[model samples]
Target: MYDIQTIFQTANPILNQMPYPMMILNPEGIVLAWNRQAEKTFGYCAEDVLGKFIPFIEEERTYFYKDLWQKIIHSADPLHLESITISTKKGEIVNTPITLKAFTIDNDRYIFCQFNLGSEEQQDLLSFNEFTSIRDGLESSFMMLSIDQEGLISYANNLFLKYSKWTPKRIIGKTFWQMFPQTPESSVVADAIWKSLQNGRQWKGEAEKITKDGQSYWVDLTAIPIFTSAKKPSNFILLENDITDKKRLQNRLEKIAYIDQETGLMNRYRLEQIVNTMISENHHFTFVYFSIDKFYSLKELYDDQAEQVLIQEFTQRMKMYFQDSSMARVSIDEFVVLTPLGEWFIQGFLTYLEQHPIYINNSTLPLSISGGITKYPDDQISFTHLMKASYAAIQKVQSEGGGSISSLTKADHKALHKKSVIEKRLLVALDKKDLKVLYQPQLDLITGKITTVEALVRWEDEEIGTVSPEVLIPIAEETGLINDIGSFMLEQACLQAAAWHRKGIDLKVSINSSVREFRDKNMVKQVRRILEDTDCPAELIQIEITEKFALEAEAETSIIQQMKQLQNEGIVFALDDFGTGYASFRYMQLLPLSQIKIDQTFISTIQYQPKSQMLIQGMIQFGKSINMSVLAEGVETQEQQDILTEFGCDAIQGYHISRPIEAKEVEKLL
Candidate 1:
């Protein structure tokens, strides 16, 4: 029924496309055909084997051939052998697989023979012993899988089945994602495998996969794509090894980054992360920053061993009281507590803390905290702005004598930054000698003549311009710049006084000195040097100290000694702003004979405040009794001047008499 010409046409094309060698023969055992592939593979050409008995099947296998032909004739299908031995044209033997067929065409029989791929001799490939060793090594060392081009599993090695806990039957034909079901991670792996095959490349990576038991494990995977001679992908050989333990260790290492090792609390780094996350979520929260007052002093008293103990105790206390809040230790004594509580609760919490105390080291230390409270999206929307604003408010509160909490107002923020800028620029301004000195005259009440001039410092910066003496003085004192400024004040006043004396000016010059500068043991020598350098008689230079610093400088024996030494050198003293400070009669009685200046507050209010008038009269009587001069300052009007003159006040200084003048204008007064 089948045509011989049609069968040969179809069969010839198929055989030539195969990578195997084959020959064809008539049923009479005469060679009929030999293809180019068979000739090349067996080291024989088509001319050598075309009409010859098909070599390699061997003439010696005549009996076996007869049996094979008989079987082929009986079976309607092609007869196949999975493995066999065959001789090449050079008489070399090969380990191979073969297929044979017999067909009847025009009442004659023809036979076809073919050999399987990679069927070279056993010696040419791996020897039997080496093949067995390699197979054992692969099974023990790797979890291997064979996936077809469609990402469907065709085979899984014994190790893969062991770790995945999947039977061979359950794993085959399943997509990679179906077996793992941990996508998109598993899907990610499948994409990587397919991409490598698509580009004819290999792929390797560490990935997470789920087992049949639904447990996750990490593995290092390596995929190799198998391709045909035409560069078309066929299957992928994927190898993996368990790396779960290593992954866990890496996770722990990453977790350590967010933890504070000292106190077992979240650190500043983690705090920033959470705050930014909450900002992106549009969550409302209050950032409350608290600092313990004089924490450094406490640390010194407690010693190094107690540092960690105190921090741990502080964190525990915060965790206990603020159970619902997120607290982070940003520094040794600083913490940021984030809460969703109302402003009333925050205010109430601060009040309660003032009443209670934290107990540690067998002593109850008072818990006084200065805090800054800022609301997210209310005070600032960015993490940096919120943090900066909160801390700035706290700094302002602490500088004004702590023990309180406050929210940042726009004005407060501007004032704080202004103060900071002034503080920084003042340092340079001082170095550049950019400050000016002006003299306010002090008039003698009885004589109606100017008796002395008080030197006052003024500063006008090129950039910030015109810093108030009230603001600059405090910053100078806090930063220890007062000593240098005080020294400059002394030298300039002495020089000007000497210049006035040269022009026949008989008035004295008084320079204000800070309590800190007054307490220095070198105060006497510094004044003496200035007077000597200026060639000004010591009697004309009076060092004026306010009543606020009355007892502070006097408390130190060294300062008391220096004052007495300078007083003996004809340098007089003036108790400036007398009524404003808490100086007792004892300070006045024990001090060398000098003068007292009534503060401006009493003079300004004398017309209405009868008590202030009485206080002023009593002060005059007391000064006279002590044989010291009494001076009234800020005599603004005739009535106030008349009252002071009637009270026998010896000296008066006020705007009514003269405004503060520059050194060039001093000649008119002289």
Candidate 2:
């Protein structure tokens, strides 16, 4: 608990220095301290307000005040009451805006209030009568100067001399314009001020002036022309407040907006600004994007200081080579340049990189730069299109194994733009339930029974209709949206299977899983959660993966552990498109696969090719020898099904059985 004396003693010196009027009150609305500015604004002395209820709350506004105070107490943001009418000590009504904030000191809460005596807009100095009435009140806080009709300083006060670092004798006879040099910006402000004063009008603005020691400072200046008895101007009086600290802070923030902190180069925003300016002028230039290969690995190998030194050294090398270009660091490892140089520029840089490698940390780091080039007015007309084209070209170089450069082509840009659109809209499709799950039945070849169906994802977007799985799956995997899409498919499939189970149909639904989806360590937990939420039996769900995914999963222990956990929960696992990739045969011993589906390529050719039929028979015998069921996909004719049935395949799924259909259609088929 704090006494009133301690609160006042701790808050007095700081409150008095503030430019605005301020007061401190206890949580119970008793006034504790009022600063000097408040006394000047409201004509109330501190002695009259201490240890008493607030004196300004009108009887008609009691409810409004209570509500505003309650908001201030409960919210972290300050509450602002604008233009509240109040009566001053002289019984004069005035409209003032006040801001209130709740704070704590010594475990006790208090409300701090600030009064805005004037509106935020810049206002001219008061007239002669009002100025004289408030001159004494303003003298203590403002810097004052009086200039004659000749623009020579006629009088300067102590505050003005103190800030300008000038003595009385040296400053009294000097011209005002001499203090501010005739720079482009200063000349404009000087003309405006002179014109306003000559017209007998007041002028208010911020100005930059030099001190005696050649240091510069900014001031919020207001100048009023003093008129004589004949209504003619005699002199002008200027009042100013030093705003040097605020201007310095703003300058620093502007520098940060354009400069990259790490390498002292321009940032992406500055790069875009320069490019847009060039485009507006119709200048022909080439845009080049570059990235360091395997930068993350190198960053992990080095310490922070070594990494910073390496990047700085790289930047220096680039600056030295591309002397005529404007460069920017867009990301940690990526950089962009805009130049008038043509194809030879990129080829020459490649040769230069080969001759010189970046050296740091007492180690020779093998460095290679991957770049993409696009020309303005040739490849793209706008800055945004040029940047996208350059990025697409760089992606091509990276996809072809990095350390080279590529130029954007019309076809390549179109395809990349389409893929980018799909990547962005795929998640939105999932959220809006625009994607659906379709089921394809697998017939048991031996019993002539339909016991299982494969769950496939299908999408028909409003903008781009009917995106096939071959195109959509790769985009989803590259953008990492496959995890969300995979989850959606699993939940929908499980719900359908649970519904079928309730109708006395023991049907198993197979969902394709990606290696990227299983990379998540929570996959097993996610599977359990979906099963519990849908009330579906674990045995009714089968997860399918391609031979490529199976080979990749064999080396990842997390994927193997998650698979075994799901297997223990009675979920089935199958390898789809088994013969399409590296079978490794080691997956047979390592993975908990219960079934394998032969790819359609071999199945479609089995009737025409003797070698394909022999291979299909061998695969069936191999699967059965390991107690795993063999299923053949894409059988279209009765002859193809007969051949697969004769080969002792356990099941077959293809056009011969049925095409993939929706859940309700599958129910009708059952």
lDDT of 1 by residue, 1-670 (tens): 1243333433443345445576666664555655557777777776665555555566678777767766776565555677767677678887777666665544666676665442222222233346445866766788988888788999999888988888999889988666555557678776776787678677777778778889887777777666555566677777788766555534432233344545566777678889999999999999988887778777787756566666776677677667889888887688888999876777676666545555667787656678889888776776666677889878989999888888888787666567767878988977887778999988876676777899999999989999888999998998899998898888889899999889888678898888799677678888888889999999898888777666765566677777789899998888988888885666665555498998898899988889998999999998889888998888889899888888899989889887889977756775
The list of candidate 2 runs beyond 4 A from truth reads 1-161, 166-214, 218-263, 267-285, 291-317, 330-334, 341-370, 376-388, 391-405, 585-590
Candidate 2 structure, TM-score to reference: 0.63
TM-score of each: 0.50, 0.63
Clashing pairs counted in every model: 0, 0
**Candidate 1, superposed: residue stretches over 4 Å from native:** 1-288, 292-311, 317-370, 373-406, 608-610
Tell me model 2's lDDT, rounded to 2 decimals: 0.83
Q: Which ten residues in a row have the lowest lDDT in candidate 2?
A: 248-257
